[model samples]
Target chain A: MGEAIVVTSGKGGVGKTTTSANIGTALALLGKKVCLVDTDIGLRNLDVVMGLENRIIYDICDVAEGRCRLNQALVKDKRFDELYMLPAAQTKDKNAISPEQVRDIVLELKKEYEYVIIDCPAGIEQGFKNAIAGADRAIVVTTPEHASVRDADRIIGLLEGSHVESPKLVVNRIRPNMVKSGDMLDIEDVIQVLNIDLIGIVPDDEHVIKAANNGEPTVMNPDSGAAIAYRNIARRILGDTVPLMPLNQKKGAFTRFKKFLGIGG
Target chain B: MTVKSNHVTIKGIKDGLVFLLDDQCEFSELLNELRYKLEHSHQNILTGPIMHVDVKLGMRNISEEQKTLILDTLKQKGNLLIRSVETQGCVPEDEAGSSLHTLCGLVRSGQVLRHEGNLLFLGDVNPGGQIICSGDVIVVGALRGMAHAGADGNEFAIIAASYMAPTQLRIAEIISRPPDEWENRESSMEFAFLRGGTMQIDKINNVGKVRPDFNVFKGV
Candidate 1:
């Protein structure tokens, strides 16, 4: 059976959907059959992020309500044949489907897919519960801000209380320059606060937004830093010991000159 | 006139009247004598202003029903109001409030770990996490969250942490200032306590100086 991994963040707008899309795409690129499930229900966004909105004939709600077969609800990705998306219904609320129904759907999908990725909605509500119902593992996404880190910590605590294994953390949208200047919380600080195993760290790359706007996942662009980070996370998810991507960019002329003169290490 | 055996003796003290019941006599004889003494005592003693009566059950193990019977007999005397019942020897330690409890794990945000007695947590308390203890609280790891020691109103309770940067610290009813005003970014271990109704944070090394009785070691 395939493993179900839920990508969640307690707070909204922390790139949970982007991370899900990129990771699922990267996994498909790694020769794995991946199925991405959007559990946000009425507030669906994963279908759009994956550029599979037009292809969604029947959603997760239709599959759960027995209106359509599981295969009929799945939308094939235009880019990767191995990647499929189970879109959430735009008209139905989260209460339309119970956790048991979601778990059943995921179990049915797991038989065909190598990795079933569930995109959890923000907040610890019914949507979040439904997303994590079938997940064997969890990935908590957060920004470097204190608010995001705090919410991530809360999500980690809740995940521990559930039957899922200990969740890993992904610190997204980290500004390296801001961290070096002591203006923003660093990776170490975020790790210290959450106290969870760090799976990956995605830098604050402008290309992520551009790729998302174009209805393409960042992982499709091989040159983007965020894409590379997502690929590394995908490798780690496959049980590969991929070293974390370095956060520091090349030094400036002044800084290199100072280092050459032995003014600072 | 026959020599009367003193089974129950009443003595007057500054605060109240002490009813010294004999420990060696049979309980039935003691009860009969006590009843007779209260019934035949001087009228002035029984009719005057209310007198606080303290019953001292020295070296006697009495049941709840028997103690209630004694109190009822005393209450029959109109002017005698029973204040307290005293028993000698140490009380049993069956209560969880008097023992130490150890918890080993991370206290994450939005999680509250409440305990009745002393708590020895072997993990970090992240921001927004809380620990409420009726007695002392000791965190062997970092304490970045809120800790309220003496949650049940014990003013002598103390909270110690290896890396003490708590967002809030409360000892009994007194709460410390915000973390920004604490100015306690020292590298050494620290502990918080209440002194003179004010919360104070000090190094763990000085805990003995502040509370000499805190040490449990008598000697080797």
Candidate 2:
């Protein structure tokens, strides 16, 4: 059966949407048929960041209501053949859908796609529940900050209780300068608080912002550190144990095995 | 599954109520009967002195589903002393976060309800359920469930019981228990108070000094 993965973070502005877009794109580039669902419902961003906002004629609500077929609501990514996005309706709130319904939709999608990556909202409220109800695994994204880490811990507790234990961790936006100066929590501290295996450690790359502004995922950029991290994470999802990339250390530290990853972990 | 204990004697125990039902009848049928009787025009189940119920099952015992139905039926009958206990991977500190009562009438297992103000529990607090407070935690009936006061770092919090014997008891960080050596001791009226960051519990005596035997007559 296809695995349904959810990208979630309890605190807002921890790059959940950005991770969702880039990770889904990276997975599709790996030749896995992936469907990205923006389950935030009202305050949606998968469409906007994907730069497919203007092309949307139908949203997820229309599919749920059966006004359109699932195929009709699916939007193809221009860059990847297998990647598709089901955008949320800005006009509706989270309560417009049911958890059972989300589960049913994910179950149906499992039959057709290799992966269904859901973009969860920023809180532990209805939106979060709606996004994760059908997920088999989850990726908790957090900044290297105490508040975000604490909220991520709480979300991990909820996920464990809600039958989605063993969620992987993604530490986004690591500014090496600040971490070295002890002004911010480093990767080790975040991992200790979260107590989970690390999947991605994305550096604060300006290339990501540029790519987003240009409607392209940073993962599409060959030299971008964030893109490389996302690609590694996507490879790790395929059962490859890619070592985490060294940050601010010598680039040639793991040079022998680096090219063997071949643009992956 | 039966109503706990092979022999159930429906009788008065001190000022409390105890209905012992033998483990023979289908729990659903028994609960349906209780609900019907309580809702009956002549029989007012809520007005009587609150009762304590102990279900001792035999052999296969009652299914988790049966126990849930019984608890729900008791709640529908106005008030229930028997609370649902979810013993799976929980701790004593969880008692601070349980309301077991209804802000909404629906109480689900594994869901914790924490209120900071003076608390009133309209329903039974199940075993896994907790009712911890910075103020007084008042269970309107039999308190066979777990409860703690001054959970938000309040040391003066005192825990009162209609019928006192919890699987675990806590007031703030202090934990109280009947002496570990005495497992068979049962009680009806007891109170636990925090003394020097440790919990000390004693039976409340209406006449003289607090007596430990006062808890011997069980079921609130």
Candidate 3:
């Protein structure tokens, strides 16, 4: 049976969907049969981030509602063969389905895939309840900001009540320089508050934006800071004991900015 | 089943409500008697106080069929609280009935327990956390999350944070972000409130010479 993993964070703009796309893609690259489900009903962004919004003719809602077959709604990723995207319906609201329905769908998907990753919605409401009903494990994503970490903690607490055990934490978009300068909350501060086992730390890299615009995940890139972190995180999930790359070990920002601008720092 | 003073008494507590299921007292006959008793009682069915009926569930000398029939009858009313005479474990009053052994915080997520009086936090409210109280908010720790006092269009609400850094701080929708430049950030506890329809954070201080009308918490 596939291990069902739900990617959820109570706060918006904390990279839940982005982490879902990359982690699912990375798992597929590792030869694991992965199916990424977007549980955000009305406001869907996983399809856009995955760059498969246009190719979607049917979604998980269609399959759950019996309008389309489950096999028909699974969108194969362009980059990986084992990776698939089960998108969410944009027209209907969160009440279109129930927690039991999501569980049933997940059970059926488990028979065919080795891993099922659910991208949960932003708030802790019915949509969240439905998304978490069938998750065997969960990954709570958060930035280094106080608000994001606070929301992540609340999400963890809710997951506990829902009987989801061992939900991991993924600190995303970490900028080492700002952390060194004391401008942003460091990874340590975030980890202390949320109190979840750390799964991965993804460094903030501009290549993420460029890759997203091109409908590509940064894990495909070999040298970007975020890409390297994502790739390392993927290897860690596959049972590789890789140490986290040393962060904030760089020099001045003026020099780094020049390199980003490609002006010969 | 024999009832006295609104309390039903069974022959034995071990095997359901028993009153000799012999041919004399049929299940239908017992139902007619119970219905007559409830109809005469002075209690509203839906809109009034809930009726807590006692029931004994188990089997001893009673036949399996009789036990099932009695249990099924109790399920229909949905108002019975099964009590076991074996241990007297009546519904197991837990901390809000959570199977888990953790002290579930009284204020759960997605629920805003508004207080028209005063609200205080014993610990810090991490982000995605909020407290919208009508009076004053006193945080025991650094208030790094969002808080809005006087949410019901009352200007009397005031938000006080020890560290005073919040994602969103508001007093009746007058919002303020901690200044982008932290050099001027106050070193003491600050309270955000509305004056002339603008949110203002005045440092809490105690002094003899007629200070700024009120005192806010000071961060040492």
Which candidate number maximizes TM-score?
1
Q: Supply the global lDDT for candidate 1.
A: 0.88
Query: Worst 10-residue stretch by lDDT in candidate 2 chain A?
Result: A249-258
Winner of 1 and 3 under TM-score: 1
TM-score-best of 1 and 2: 1
Q: What is the C-alpha local distance difference test score of each model?
A: 0.88, 0.72, 0.71
lDDT of 3 by residue, A1-265 (tens): 8889999999998888888888888888778999999999999988888899889999888999999889999999887888888999999989998999899999989999999999999999999999998899888899988678767887887887777877888899888879878999988888756666888998888888888788888778877877777777777776798888788546598979888999954
Model 1 lDDT per residue over A1-265, tens place: 9999999999999999999999999999999999999999999999888888888899999999999999999999999989999999999898999999999999999999999999999999899899999999999999999899989999999999999999999999989889989899989989988888999999999999888888899999988999999999999999999999888755789988898999973
The share of true interface contacts that also appear in candidate 3 amounts to 0.29
Question: How do all the candidates rank in terms of lDDT, highest first?
Answer: 1, 2, 3
> What tens-digit string does per-residue lDDT give for candidate 1 at B6-113?
878888899768998875568878888889888788778777899999998664567898899899999998889999987651222232226678988989899999
What candidate 1 gets wrong by more than 4 Å, as runs, is A251-265, B1-97, B181-184, B216-220
- Tens-digit lDDT track of model 2 for B164-219: 54657777787766566433456555667666677776664531122211233432
Candidate 3 lDDT, tens digit per residue, B6-84?
2223343343333222222344555455554444533444124333444332112334675556556544545444443
DockQ scores for all predicted structures: 0.68, 0.02, 0.16
Interface residue Cα RMSD of candidate 3 after superposition: 3.6
**CAPRI band of model 2?**
incorrect
* Greater-DockQ candidate between 1 and 3: 1
Pairs in clash, predicted candidate 3: A150-B126, A150-B127, A151-B127, B188-B219, B189-B218, B189-B219, B204-B216
